[model samples]
Target: MVLRDPLRGLARRRARWLAVTAVGLAGFVVFVVAVAVYRLTAADPVFDRGDISGLIVVFAVSLGFAGLGGLRLRVLARRIRDTASENGFGGWLPAPSAADDDRRIDFGAETGRLRRTTRRAAALVLVWVALFTGGLAGMSLLDEAAGELLATGDRVPGVVLSVYDPGKGTPSMRVRFGSRTAKIVRDSGHHYHVGEAVTVVVDPADPEHVRTTEEQNENQFVFGLCLVALLLGLAGAPVAAGAALGWRRRARAVGVTGWRVATVDVVPDRSIGGRKRPPPTIHVRYRDGTGIVLRAVLSTHGAKALADFTDRLAWVGGWGREMAVLFPQGPRRPGPYAVPAAAKTPRAASAFRRSRR
Candidate 1:
């Protein structure tokens, strides 16, 4: 299966699919390992008998599995390389050998515009749902962790030495912790008289910092949960938002049959993280028969591959969709990024292909 200029879009689509699959598989592996570790160790002390030897055995087993997986991957790659000239990944995608010649190719009538749109839209929706759900759960966990860390992780013991009334309904107490004494107002619900013992967690490094614990046993995983949840929530929020915006755009967009590249711009990296990333964004300008201009921010490889840009079908939208609702700056603002657009397009006759049985 060789992909020529007409099929470069397929390459881009497959690349994205492969990247996402790799990430999903890696995440599943990590989650399974984490669950197994928690199940195995949550019931026992960190340094129980035979724990060190057990961990060593587990490490060895894991290493062996990884080696085997790597070997299998290599074998698969070798097979792909050898048989690539005859078949393309068992007829799914175009092999490198197919693109070596200058022969014009067609994917058939079944792989039509409507089918492509449906497939891309469904994938985008699934991604959006997963990201939004994960982010929401992470935020809730983060809040709970913060509360637990405040209440239990920093407490010290204190004794109420004296109680006094200042003419108000609320009473005050002088609490003593070690050699330090501090005046504190009693909470309206707390029935504290004089000479009462209370557990107050205080920062050892900071004497002024104090907190009282109401919950018993305390949550030991608060700090770890907080860090993990914070990271997940922060990372997933933007991805979820972007996916949702893309989903909405596709839902409300007026489909343009084909788009031609008007220009390509390689701009300087201006983003915060761009200081270390030397690769600038590849911004491609596209226009349809209506003279309406749309743009796509692509990777350098995608841009380079689409430089010919003839007969390429792309999906783009203007100010009419939910872009105004999602973006505070409004949809009238000019920006470079078109949804559902790809680097490849089909000729008018080949746009519709026969269904593969």
Candidate 2:
């Protein structure tokens, strides 16, 4: 039916978002690990060159991980639904009882819990990254300050490899200190030109440290790290909040039992609102004795979700099993065993006998 297509589309969209989030979290973790390894091992210049290839590898890994994660979630959803059916819940699954909340149904409370958990987990990972990056930046500044206090570095004659204006008004210089190159911003009254010989100071013990002005050369690196941390924190904050909000909404709906169930009698190809376009028209009849009728025109995605529920109803309806219907303005409705073929079944005959008893 038209319902399966829409449900499958929704599943695909969910998978896509899940994959993107997985990739982002994985990428950030990898970055932190790479930086730690580089600093701890004091890797050589070849390791620095390898950073470019490392980035390519990270992208490839992220894509691979995303694909695997998406497929896993889809499979999990299918498994949950199948398990619910086998448990004699029929084609429709309900939310777990409050006392027995460990049980889960794919389209109901279970899915909500999964989303909330995933969002919380992702948010926590990002918070950890932000803390780590901020700490690293702080440590870098503190170490530089200590180095200056100890006067450990000596001033040496170095050549300016290049002078580039980074559009910050003040020019920055890439100076060659012995065999190493360091980019240092020119202080007030200090001017530099390409290939010009300049006096640069270096730490004899750690040649990587070079000081020229009071404005810390390493501040730029710390600033960049802090900026990344801030961005990650910002992205994570809203996602966590939204997920929490969704959880609360779902909880309210589940607790209140406000929605009534209905079965789709027919899905019209044309819009019910007299529009020329197809407007997701569904003609459904209330399953309860009230004999209420409904014609719903919903969004594409909403239509898909409703169609899926109706498809389930059709399967059980064929067997004369009563299905639940969710109504727009009334109490939940129970379906009638309107199909005569269901009455001929041995199970139905036995059920009829039991009802009389």
Which has the greatest TM-score?
2
Candidate 1, residues 1-357, lDDT tens digits: the string is 122332234434534544554454455445544544353223222645686676666555555555555455445433433443233221212212322222221222212332354455456546644554454454445445435556556666888889777785445667787888866645434677677887765655655645455322222354345445435544544444444434433333222111222333333344586352333322332332111222232322123223333333322221211111011111234322233332223211222121101
Instruction: Return the TM-score for each candidate structure.
Output: 0.31, 0.36
Candidate 2: clashing pairs of residues: 260-325, 260-326, 260-327, 261-325, 261-326, 262-325, 262-326
Which regions of candidate 1 are displaced past 4 Å?
1-45, 86-196, 199-205, 211-357
Residue 104 displacement (Å), model 1: 17
| Candidate 2 residue runs with Cα over 4 Å from true position | 1-152, 157-161, 166-172, 176-199, 219-226, 262-357
Q: What is candidate 1's CA lDDT for residue 242?
A: 42
lDDT of 2 by residue, 128-233 (tens): 5566557556655544463573365677777878877766554677888777789876543456667777667676777676766332455555555655664565
TM-score of 2: 0.36
lDDT of 1: 0.39
